[model samples]
Each structure stands twice: as structure tokens, then as C-alpha cells.
Target: MDENKSYLYDFIKGLWKENPVLVQLLGMCPTLAVTNAVENAIAMSVAVVFVLTASAIIISLIRKLIPAQVRIASYIVVIATFVTMADRYLAAFYPAQSKALGPFIPLIVVNCIILGRMEAFASKNGVFRSILDALGMSFGFAIALLLMSSFREILGNGTWLNMRVLGSWWDNWMVMILPPGAFLTLGTIVGVSRFIQTKLKKA
Candidate 1:
């Protein structure tokens, strides 16, 4: 029972309490860059989920074999391997998303969220726990991306996933799909998240 609770706690915390994007503020690059549209956000989120979870599993399994001196480098190599697979698969089958994502997909190798988990949780824990942690963080990352994308896409383009959400009367806010819009959305999300967390604590 204690073990189950421990696993549950680890998994649940990342969903909201320690969300990588909203609360922890990690992986800001993709969070702000690719979130101009819902499709882009989904592709980035899926890629991150695969990369973070797979990388964590491998790192946890081989933690004992990796020397501390070159551990960081080893982690990057493993991360890059999975990232390459994801990139190629997307390019071959999901060319549109791949093209839209461009260098961002290949850049997952350096995502601090993935590397941070490998170094902090995976290296110190067993495979099962590491997987759970990776999943939790992945979901948290996805949620933030979805939230950001939903807002940007709907308000900016007056559509969600290229499907119209607002009527003709609604004027699309062009700024919402631009770089400055990403900053505004991120700041708003972070601020709202902080306020909610504070309220929850008080309650």
C-alpha cells in the first residue's frame, strides 16, 4: 500500500503541482515556439512524451553502467537516439507536422525536461518509478501545451485544429498567433497557475 501511494504521489504531482511548463517552467522553448497552432502543439507534445518516457526508461536501466564523469554526455546520446527515431518517423509519415515543427523536433535532444528527469529521478530510482515520473511529467507538459495551443489557435485563427470554432462575427486576433502572443499567453498561464496554486494552498 505504501509503495502504491508513493508511485501515485510521484505521478500525480507532476500533473499540476509540479507541472514542467506551468509550475516548473521548464522547456519554455517549444512551449512558446510551437504553440501557435493546436496541431503543432499536439505534435510537439507527442514527441516530448515519447522522448522523455523512452529516454527515462533507458537511462534508469543503464544507470549503474554509466560513469558519473560522462553521465551527462551519455544521457544526451541516448536522448538523441530516440529523438532521431521520432524525427524520422514524423518526416516519413507525418511530413506536414514534421515540416511545421522543423528543427524543433530534432532539438528535443537538448530539452531540459528530459535531461533533468534522467539526471534527477531516473538515475537515482528504479525503472518503474522512473517511468512513472516520466509519464507524469509528460502529461503535465502535454496539458500545458494543449492549453496554450487551444487559446492561441482559437483566438488567433478563430479555429481549433483548423476547424472553425468562432463564428464569422468574431474577428481573429492576429497577434495571438505571433511571437509576442506566445509570450503573453505563457505569462498569463504562469500567472493563473500560480494564483490557483496559492488559492489551493490556502483552502
Candidate 2:
């Protein structure tokens, strides 16, 4: 019972306490770039979830076998292999999203979030624990991306998931779908989250 609880905690923390995008600020490049639309956000999140989870499994399984001197390089190689698989899969089945995302898909190789998890958690944990951690982190990342994309798409295009939502009388905010919009949303979220945390702590 105690062991399972610990595992649960590991999986839960990344959703908020240690969120890769919101809390740790990792993978901001993809988070901000591909979040202009809900579809792009979902696609990017799926790829990250697949790559992060798969890489964590492999890394944990082979952690001990990797020499300490070359562990970083080894981790990159392993991460790259999974990244390639994800990139190819996306390109094959979701050509439009793949094109929309562009090199960001391939650049997953160096995403600090994945590498950081491999080094900080997966490389030192059991397979089950590592898998949980990866899932948690990826889910957290997905949440942030979704929220960001939702705000951007709805306000900018007056649509949700490319489907028109607002009435014809509504004029969309063009700025909400641009690069600056990403920064504004991210900054606001971070600020609000921090404020909430501070209040909770004071209570």
C-alpha cells in the first residue's frame, strides 16, 4: 500500500507541483510555438507524451549498463531514436500538423524536459516509477499547451479546434494568435499560478 502511494505521488506531482512547462519552464520553445491552434497543441502534446514515455522506459531499463562518463551522450542517443520514430510517425500520418510544426518535431531531441527527466528521474529510478514520472510530466505539459492554445484560438479566431464558436458579430482579436500572444499568456499564467501558491502557503 505504501509503495503504491509513493508511485501515485510521483505521477501526481508533475501535473502541477513540478509541471514541465508551467512550473519548471522546460520545453517553452514548443509550448509557445505550436500552441497557436488547438490542433497543433494536441499534436505536439501527443508526440511529447509518446517520446518521453518511450524514452523513459528504455533509459530506465538500461541505466545501469551505461558508463558514467558517457551517460549524457548515451541518453541523447536513446532519446534521439525515440524522437525519430515519433517524428516519422507524425510526418506519415499527420502531414499537415507535421508541416505546421516544422522542425520543432525533430528538435525534440534536445528538449530539456526529456533530457532533464532522463537524468534527474528515469536514469535513477525503476521502470514503473520512471514511466509514471514521464506520464505525469507529459500530461502536465499537455495541460499547459491546451490551456494556452484554447485561449489563443478562441480569442483570436473566435473558434475552438478550428470550429467557429463566436457569433458573426464578434470580431476576433488578431493579436491573440501571434507570437506576442504566447508570451502574454505564458506570463499571465505564471504570475497567477505563483500568486495562488503564495496565498496557499500563507494560509
Candidate 3:
């Protein structure tokens, strides 16, 4: 029962309480860069989920074998390998999303979120625990990306996933599609999230 509780807590925490982007502020690059559209956000999230989970599993399995002095380098190599696989797979099959994402796919190798997990959670934990943590973090990332993308798409383009949701009367907020808009939108989200969290704690 205690073990199950532990796993559940670890998994649930990342969903909101400790979200990588909104909470922990990790992986801001992709969060702001690729979130101009819903499709791009989802694509980035999927790649991150795969890379983070796979790398966490691999790192957890081999943690004992890795020397402390060179563990960071080892982790990067493992992360880079999976990133390459994801990049090529996307480029081959989902070429449009692959093109949209472009260098950001390769940039995952250096994404602090993945590396932070390997160093902080996976390195010292058992494989099962690491996997749970990775899943939670990945979901957290996905949720944030989805929320950001949805908001940006609706306001900026007056569409969701390329389908017009708002009527023709609605004038799109051109700023929502720009770089400044990403920052503004994310800032608003983070602020509201914190406010809600504070209220929940009081309640």
C-alpha cells in the first residue's frame, strides 16, 4: 500500500503541482517556440514524452554502471541517441510536423527537463519509480503545451487545429501568434496557475 501510494504521488505531482513548464520552468525553449500552433505543440509533446520516458528507463537501468564523474556525459549520449531516432522517424513519416518542428527536435538532447530528470530522479531511483516520474513529467509537459497551443491558436488564428471555431465576426488577435504573445500567454497562465494553487491550499 505504501509503495502504491508513493508511485501515485510521484505520478500525480507532475500533472499540475510540479509541472515542468508551469511549475518547474524547465524546457522553456520548445514551450514558447513551437507552441504557435496546436499541431506543433502536440508533436513536440509526443517527442518529449518518448525521449524523456525512454531515456529515464535507460538511465535508471544503467545507473549503477555509470561512473559518477562522467554520468552527465553518458546521459547526454543516451538522450541524443533517442532524439536522433525520434527526429528521423518524424522526418520520414510526419514530414510536415517534422518540418515545422525543425531543429527543435534535435534540441531535445539539451532540453533541461529530460536531463534534469535523469540527474535528479532517475539516477538514484529504481527503474519503476523513474518510469513513473518520467510519465508524470511528460504528461505535465503535454498538458502545458496543449493548453498554450489551444489558447494561442484560438486567439491568434481564430481556429483550433486549423478548424475555425470562432465565427467570422471574431477578429484574430494578431499578437497572440507572435513571440511576444507566447511570453504574454505563458505569463498569464503561470500567474493564474499560481493563484489557483494558492486558493486551493487555503481552501
TM-score of each: 0.97, 0.96, 0.97
The clash tally of candidate 2 reads 0
Q: Write the per-residue lDDT of candidate 2 for residues 14-63, one digit (tens) a residue.
A: 89888888889999999889989999999999999999999999999999
Model 2: pairs clashing at backbone N, Cα or C within 3 Å:
none
Clashing residue pairs for model 1: none
Give the range where candidate 1 is weakest over 10 consecutive residues by summed lDDT: 1-10
Candidate RMSDs in order = 1.6, 1.9, 1.6
> Among these predicted structures, which one has the highest lDDT?
3
Residue 8 C-alpha lDDT in model 3: 90
Give me the displacement of residue 25 in model 1, in angstroms.
0.8
What C-alpha lDDT values do all the predictions have? 0.94, 0.93, 0.95
Which digits, one per residue and each the tens of the lDDT, describe model 1 over residues 134-168?
A: 99999999999999999999999999999998999
TM-score for candidate 2, residues paired by index: 0.96
Q: In candidate 3, where is summed lDDT lowest over 10 consecutive residues?
A: 1-10
